[model samples]
Target: MILNNPSRKEIKNVLDHAKTIAVIGLSPNPSRTSYIVSESMQRAGYRIIPVNPRADTVLGEKSYASLSDIPEKVDIVNVFRRSEFLEGIADEFIKIDCPVFWTQLNVVDENVFNRLADVGYTVIMDRCIKVEHAILK
Candidate 1:
């Protein structure tokens, strides 16, 4: 598991301050966890950028194929992909330079956590943003 996961204070701070999030691996299917989480964040007033190679739009927002394709800066990059793909996503995140990297529940990648945190990113792994939001709010 990714160590040094964000504390309650850090997670709360992130939710309080973050205005926009790029949700990687977001799905068009409403039943999917990615879609539900993105929707919840949107409801909470965060500008949700749905990023999926196969989708043009999700939850009424225009989606991008990748983070690099996004036109504006994102405060957070919430990932829903498997752990095996995280390093590649981390490589992409390095280019985007978003301050926060959030890997959803059950997704954990220690290498990504170390590398991203080393570069000053606030990384959260094996956590669901929606669940946290519900608790912290």
Candidate 2:
């Protein structure tokens, strides 16, 4: 069965209450969309955690090799990786206690969505978190 994302109101609620966002595949380069979006979010008051195995840091925050490496509480797991990499990310996500799993624009995986949703995780796919926050907040 196809999976649907939460409504605008639901998304707004998530953004409204979220304090920290863990960004998977976040790039250190300022030219990348991930960096730009994450920077915007960071400036907007939400703590941004960079989850990149190769980078040491991004947006002035320490970078973690994976989701499991983060030592703090993560309210949202925002993904910038391709759809093919989502399964691995989902695996790491489940190992953590993040409440929301968000895949960036054009990133979607039915299996990942189903798996996370089945386990009562709030999954938002193929949507830009920055845009949503800008419009909803």
What TM-score do all the candidates reach, one by one? Answer: 0.96, 0.97
Q: Candidate 2 lDDT, tens digit per residue, 1-137?
A: 35599999999999999999999999999999999999999999999999999999899999999899999999999999999999998998999988999999999899999999998999999999999999998
The digit string of per-residue lDDT tens for model 1 on 24-114 reads 9999999998998889989999999999989989999999999999999899999999999999999998898589999999899888899
The reply for model 2, stretches above 4 Å from the true place, is: none
Ten consecutive residues with minimal summed lDDT in candidate 2? 1-10
- How does model 1 fare in lDDT? 0.92
Candidate 2 has which clashing residue pairs, if any? none
lDDT of each: 0.92, 0.94
Locate the minimum summed-lDDT window of 10 residues in model 1: 1-10
Candidate 1 stretches greater than 4 Å from native: none
How many collisions between residues are there in candidate 2? 0
> What is candidate 1's TM-score against the reference?
0.96
